[model samples]
Target: MTETTMPAAPGAVPHRTLPAGALPHDWRAVDEGWGRRGPDFATLSEPSACREYVALHHALGVDHGDHLLDVACGAGLAVELAALRGATCAGVDASARLVDVARVRSPEADLRVGDMHDLPWPDATFTVVSSFRGVWGTTPGALDEIRRVLVPGGRLGLTVWGHVKASPGAWALAPFRLAAEPQVRNQAAMTSLGRPGVGEAVLEAAGFVDVRRVRIPFAWEFADPATYARALASTGPAFVAIQEVGEPAFLAAAERGATAHVRAGLPLRAEVDVTGFLARTAAAR
Candidate 1:
């Protein structure tokens, strides 16, 4: 087994370097109601991650007893599945609120609130490392963290959000047409995915190899306009931002727009790009 540790931060820590930890920033504001929506994203996110897990298990010959680390493990989505699969699973995230929810949602996990740049564990601590729909790191810190923890021949499994050009993950917004102006105003307040392959290039820079990419095309379905509107409002970052612009009027309008779309019987399909990567360890001499 090869041992590794997250690389040192460029300048210096206010304190000494910590081991594998979660992100330093707070994320609870954006992720608080993550698992409470109509469809359990907790369940949706991981099974979707299963394809990559299977790839790693097949390519690297993973053992059920191998330790697995789920990065940015919101609401224990990947945590529960890892536990169910018989791996000794742990999760790390920047949001303590989400971590707490993850712990309650999947009591079987070893969840921690720490930064990917400063993981809490020692070297060669995990056999498999995985992350789901997480925000991009400002630096290549996560890759450094991953390399540090994985053993020789250790595998990496990541499910990344693919770039959408035309739709741009924007179909759900159509149902909320009434709320468009407000939503657009709301979206102005946050960070963004700058462009495509930004993450892919970062993964390469972090020293990962055998990077395989694929897209998972799926539809976000709703029983009706009201349900669809609520579902969107309940979980999405964009939807949340719109509420800041006086939600009462926008919500009412969105509801009517959504009802119109529902009656039109449009499929309302949007494609999501979920890419996976697999790699091994070297330079352990």
Candidate 2:
């Protein structure tokens, strides 16, 4: 499958790099949210996402020496997994605290704190790029930046929460959305690529080829409704909801949403449907 390539612009586009200590002004909110949830993400989210990366590695034909980049790589767990499979790894994330955890987890890795839209890398920097629930609602500029940093024919993989209709916990987002202020922008980002063909269209527009999607079985389990609510409240959108409606109200709504998924007095288990996309850039640049 042929794909259009973004011609290298050399001096025309000055490669932008951030100071190792520099971070975007708006990143504070994200940093705070993820920082608070860093341990949970490391214990819960990252493991769930990384469990599905084996297929992605196979599809991309990752090799021992391949340079891999995990965009929006929270806690660097995925990069650590890739390193286990023999790939050299680097990662970028918006949360300084999460990056700190990642640094400790993969001390040899080149982990950086930065926005996905303005990655701190030069052109053709990686052989494979992966983003787990990171690319949604990101601007076209971010997509361009992803393509720019990939070598010709480099593989790209992204995972988004699959369409809620396909999940048993279909009402998962109801409480959050219902409580979220109407003025909250990009509130739909959590499920932006959830619909059929939505993620593929976005990837193709960014010059990706051979785009394919697969649904992976994932579930979030919490010992009780309160724990479930707290976990849910840690998400980025939940942060927005907390800001709009306050944390107490937000967690109340989350608990209301969580009760529906509780089972057998064991735990509240919410089935998550994850849709992953794998595609490649054009080989002949």
Candidate 3:
């Protein structure tokens, strides 16, 4: 948590501090994939997350006095929204390209490109923290880092895709199956936190208190199947599928999956379950 100024990437805002040592190999790989279509994600995919961001901020009571940090804050949409709600905001993501977009969106925010497992802020630097579908079952260690930067009794809000297979939007995500088998397995592990009682157990184990679940509103809407395919292709999961099957194959499969859901004049809509968790750091004794 000690502050050390580090050189910022080209087009990135000056970071508050840099994590010690080289970036983790796994995180670098993740950054490579997600940063592939950064602008497409910023313009097409990230807007759909507005409802989730507003809902979680409401649940956490974010306001003018709060200092907020958004972990894995893709393109800084959530951070921008928080700033509009009058909270001072900061964010971090592994993808430098995505972070560049975020810097443009929220010029004053303390946004950085860094690993979630090793946040660069000093201890107890934030009053609230949020991660929308960012932290996963496979990265529960990130929770320990989240806890480190929150002041006593500080709030935490997180979201994860919930009951995805049973949701109306399942079709929208079906193309992710084209990823190699190991990537598919990793996806399952990532979403495991959304299962019943799973997130609460993990939060408590990480020393968070008052853990509870809340339903978050989420949906994906596209003007047509082709647009849907374009948006999906911008996501990290889709990048994995693209790696295995190639971008053309992945886009074709996504378009085919969405075709049945298309309406003549209406946008193709997919409503998926999203689970939100609200918890707090233990109070100062």
Q: RMSD to the native, candidate 2? A: 5.8
Judge candidate 1 against the unseen true structure and give its global Cα lDDT, from 0 to 1: 0.54
State how far residue 175 of model 3 sits from its true place (Å): 0.3
Which regions in candidate 3 have their CA more than 4 angstroms from the true location? 1-22
List, residue by residue over 146-211, the lDDT tens digit for candidate 2: 888899999888777776666787665555564444423354543566577778888898898999
Better of 2 and 3 by lDDT: 3
Per-prediction CA RMSD (Å): 7.0, 5.8, 5.7
Residue 204 deviation, candidate 3, in Å?
0.2
Task: Name the regions of candidate 2 deviating beyond 4 angstroms.
Answer: 1-19, 183-185
Backbone clash count for every predicted candidate, in the order shown: 18, 0, 0
Better of 1 and 3 by TM-score: 3
Report the Cα lDDT for residue 70, model 3: 96
Ranking by lDDT: 3, 2, 1
lDDT of 1 by residue, 193-260 (tens): 22456555666777876665544443455556555555455444423434444545545555666564
lDDT for 181 in candidate 2 is 48
